[model samples]
Target: MPEIRNFCIIAHIDHGKSTLADRLLERTGAITEREMQEQILDDMDLERERGITIKSHAIKMDYERPNGEKVIFNLIDTPGHVDFAYEVSRALKACEGALLVVDAAQGVEAQTISTLYQAIDQDLEIVPVINKIDLPGADIEGVSQQIVDLIGCDHKDILQVSGKTGDGVDLLLEAVYELIPGPGREKDKPLKALIFDSIFNTYRGSIVYVRVMEGTLHKGEGIRFMATDKEYDAEEIGYLKLEKMKTDKLEAGEVGYVIGSVKSLQDARVGDTLTTTKNPAKEPIPGYQEVKPMVFSGIYPTDSDDFEDLRSALEKLQLNDASLSYQPETSKALGFGFRAGFLGLLHMEIVQERLDREFDIDIITTVPNVEYEVHKMEKSEVVKKIVDNPSEMPDPGKVEQVYEPYIKASIITPSEYIGPIMNLCQERRGNYINQLHMQSNRVEITYELPMAEVVFDFYDRLKSSTRGYASLDYEFLEYRKGDLVRLDILLNGDPVDALSSITHRDKAYDLGRKLCGKLKELIPQQQFEVAIQAAIGSRVIARDTIRAMRKDVTAKCYGGDISRKRKLLEKQKEGKKRMKNVGSVEVPQEAFLAVLSMDDD
Candidate 1:
């Protein structure tokens, strides 16, 4: 316990957190030069494809000091995105300290500050390291001052290292041991361990990653999960190295894994406490909260027959990703589907991509939406309803008011682009909050923006406006009263339920016009002219016309028979009237997906 040290790495996305982990593994001789891989801790194929860490990984490394003393290092790599903040919280609880990695050229970004505050709140010792110093644009002096000014850490103590070149990495390992203390000792106490993370394997069942706080856990011991109170025999106990290395037992103040023959992933939950069945701990560990999904969208298979297969694929995927939540829903236009909730936009995209690539399933995802509160008045009583889908909104006459979710968004960038960012936020219905100057040149702007405004292409536009120098982070604030109305799209004369959306009253006309124009371009022309209109309640805000495909019936006629051509045209017009009464527009799948790309103008 005296020589064992546990710590995690936290950083903003693309700040080289994964690269630093690889360098640390190399320095400790955990993997030889031959076994080295880029982003070694990011295990998912999707993660590698997207070049981001979506999940947390823990590995044990053995390091030796200059005094010929051996020390055990338990390294946990956490996700840098705000969507996985819950996972970061769990990882921080299992470790004594964290390494806050910052890019030398970029200084501190949005996620950097957000994660740093989380670590500070957790009371974890933070070691600030400036990475990517080998780049020509790397500004070591500027970044060091930023750390001192923003985080209030000593500037002289900050470690300057290049994760790419492996420069100054050996000193970082030494600093970890000197700065981070070992786990507290309680060998005589009853069995107590905190489950920080878990995974499901087809052959071995559930492999739970745990940090032993007290007592010992041995192989073949019956243990109970504090959250579920379900007992399972620990089939194997071991340390989490590059692979699971079997051990006879794990003692107090060590981080490792337990392979219990748990049948389901829910049984081995993260943030749950584990204790021996014979002598259970008096209470469960603190700070265990169930994750609630922040965004909701409908997912439907391209082929309705694959609904069952989609359900099965979702079941298997959820076994590993417990944060994903879904329930069966049917759309009139899309047929059978499921309304799934996710943590953020990236999370929603990742899940959709995995379902497509891994499961070999073609899916059509509707436009993402947030949960809204609808207040309806019936006589003298008021009924509050939570609506996740816009099509499910009550009639305009019955609804008294509507409230939409808002977020406290933080944007960190160079001071030059502050004006454009402010204009963009205001256009998206963002209310001004406050701004602060960090380290002189960098600025942090706060705004209260509706969640609906930030969901689609907001980040992309911000990057474009700032020349990719700005980063945004947001948290859900309470719902507020909104003067919003439901915008419905009508094809010919009938409304399309899937194309309905909730928008602010002021922007309703412009958004409706855009959506109607987009649909007109996407929907193929039918035998009869199609009238595409965007409506709000009983009024039409925008309209577009798709001309019917014309056929020159008198083109083959000859011999200067002008009167004969006119008679043929008359017959053709009469036939077209009959076809127009019975024809229906055949909208392609692209029409449904086009709504996803609609942005705030």
Candidate 2:
């Protein structure tokens, strides 16, 4: 264990974390110069195209010191986005130290502060490294000072490096071995390993990535999940060098994958403890919390026959992303679908895009929402129930109070756009908390806001208001009592279940009116006139009509008698009245999605 080191890399999005990983890999000879690629740690095409890491990965590398001593380094690369906080936490738990990379040009953004707190909470040894020194206007001294002010680190200990040019990376690796202590060696103890992450395969059911905490784990051994108590036979064990490399045994303080005869992904849950069946550990490790979904929406297939295919795709997606949660749902207007939950807006968008591009399925999504706590009067007493769907919300008279989720949002931007940014946040019902004057004439403002408001295009609007000069990060706060109302959209007096939403009562009328007008434009004109109305309970606040198609009966008459034209017009009017009584309005898929495209605050 003295020669082995476990560490992870954490940074803000697009702050040279992946580039640094590639440079370190090249410097250590993990991959030769011919095999190197930009952002090699990001394996997904979506991640590569966007230049961000969405998942955490573990790799084993062999590095030699100047004294010709060999050291084994287990490096885990983590996601920098706020949506993947759970992923970041899992990676942090497996490491003894972290490399906190900061961009020299853009010093101490919102996510950098957020990730710093997480690493501090884990009590891991943090080594600050200022990256991207080759860029124009790179301020190494300014960033180093910011690190000292924010994290209370000594300015002299901060290292400066350029990830693009592979400068000072060798010195950074040597500092890692000298500064961070290796894991303690253990023996004569029961086998205990922590499953930090896992993925599914068709031939081999579940491949669980683990970090051994106590004893040895070998191939062809019987193991049991400490949480679920389910048993499995380990089929293979190996290292994760961006690929599965087979090995016979994995000892304490080593990170590797364990292929077992497990049927489903749920059987091998992330954060669960794994132990050998014959000699199990005395107790499971602490800090195994389940991930709760922050955003919820309905996903319906465009073709009703493809509902089964959508379900299969969701199940497969859940196998890889354990944070995703879903259940079957039926909508009156959308037919059969599922109500899916995600970590945040980005997580939700990525899942939707993958379903379309990877699975070849076309789907329509409702406006995103967060869970609400509804308190209703039951038997002369108040009863509370958590409601995620607006259609499931209770009537206003039956409830005593309604609580909506809120988040503490942090924004870092140049001082020039502070006025417009504050105005935008206030328009969305944000409550100002405090502000701090940062270096480089920048400001960091904190606000308390409704999660619903931010879930639908809040980030986009913020960027537009600030001209893309601002960065934002947020964390979930507690639920607070809110004046909430469920707004329902009705087509020809029939309520559409999929178009219902929960909003603040003060802004409900304006939002309802806007939705009614948008739906009027999206729904095609029909033979019979269709009335679109937005209602709150029994009160209709807004209404619009799609005019019926008009026919030129007189044109077809040519030089015929006037009486013939009158007779044709009367017959047509009678036919329209009959059709209006029996026909139903067909709302297009775009009509349901149009609610999400609205930019009005």
Candidate 3:
């Protein structure tokens, strides 16, 4: 245990966390030249294609020091996006130390500060590292000072390295071995292990990734999950390398995987305690907080027959991503579906894409919204209800007050772009908190913004307005009273439950008008005119019409008398009115997607 070092890499997005990880893996001889690749820890094709890390990856490395001492380093590379902050928190809990990598050019951004605070809360030893020093714009001295102010570490204690060129990585490794202490726990104690992560395997049942906090786990041992109280035989036990390396036993402070007869991820949840059935620990590990999803949207199978298949797919996915929460729901427009909750909009998009590519399920997703607290009068007594879907909200007349979720958002950007960023925030109805000027010309601005306003295209707009120089990190603050209302979209005079959204009263009229215009463009023209109306209760706020495909009944009587043509036109008008009454408009999938991007401009 003295030679074992377990640590994770935490950083802001695109700050060279994965690149730095690759250099360390190469330096430690974990992967050979033939297998070398960029962002090697990001194995998912979606992650590579998007140049981002989604899931946290754990790997073991064997490094030999100059003094002939061998060290075992368990490195977990985590995603840098704010949407995956839960992943970072889980990774931090399993390690004894962390490498807080900051970009030399970008310095410390919003996510950097947010993740650093998480690591600090975990009481992990933080080693500051400045990455991408090879860039011509690299501000090593300025960033080093920023690190000093942020972490309170000495200026010389910070390590400077270029992840792209593999410079100064060897020294960084030395810091990990010397500065970061090894896991300190007794092996003789009763068995106690923390399941940090788990994944579902088709043939193997469930593969659980565990960090042994106490005692030892051997191959073929009878194990049990304390939370679930389910027992299974440990069929296989091994250390996590580039691949699973089978081992006879795992000692205290070791990180590895265990294959068992557990049927699904639900049986072996992440953050659950694992112990031997015979000598179970007296108590489970503390500090396990259930993930609360921030954004809610309905996911329906494009084909109704695939409903059961979609459920099974979501179960498998939940095993891997515990942050995803869902429950069965039925919609009049979309039919049977699950209203799924996600960490953010990107997380929702990724889940949808994974369902399509990995599970081959065609799904329709509704407009995303945040959970709202509705205080309504029931029989002269006020009752509070949590409503995620706008359709689930009670009648406006009975509701006394509605509170929307708010977030404390922190944005870090260069001083030059602060005006545009602030204006953008103000346009979203943000309440200014405070601002602080950090080292160099960079500034950190804080604001209290409603989560509903940030859910749609806020991140994309922020990036474009700042020219990709700004980084944003936010957390749920509290629910605040807001003059909110449910905006309903009507297709041919029928309210589509799937198209209803809870929005602030101030923005409802403008949003309704925009939604109606967008739907008019995407909804195909029918034989009869299609009226797209946005409404609140019985009052229509905005309306648009898609002209019907005309048949020109008068064309056949071109040379007829004026009265004959008028008679033909009147008959055609009656036919159109009758068709409009019976015709049910089929809203294409594109129109549902258009609702999500209505505020892009």
In Å, residue 571's CA in model 3 sits off its true spot by: 2.3
Which pairs in model 3 have colliding backbones? none
Deviation in Å, model 1, residue 391 alpha carbon: 1.4
Query: Where is model 1 poorest over a 10-residue stretch in terms of lDDT?
Result: 592-601
Model 1 C-alpha lDDT per residue in residues 139-203, reported as the tens digit of each score: 99999999999778888789999999999998999999999878887877888899988889888
Q: What does candidate 3's lDDT look like per residue over 5-69, in tens digits?
A: 99998787788888888999999999999999888999888988887889888999999998988
As for TM-score, the candidate ahead, 1 or 3, is 1
| Superposed Cα deviation of residue 555, candidate 3 (Å) | 3.4
Question: Candidate 1: misplaced stretches above 4 Å?
Answer: 378-380, 554-570, 599-601
Candidate 1: give the clashing pairs.
none
C-alpha RMSD by candidate, in order: 2.0, 2.1, 2.2
Each model's lDDT: 0.90, 0.90, 0.90
lDDT of 2 by residue, 210-307 (tens): 98988998899999998889999888999988668999988888899999868888889888899999899989977787789999999999999999
Clashes of 3: 0
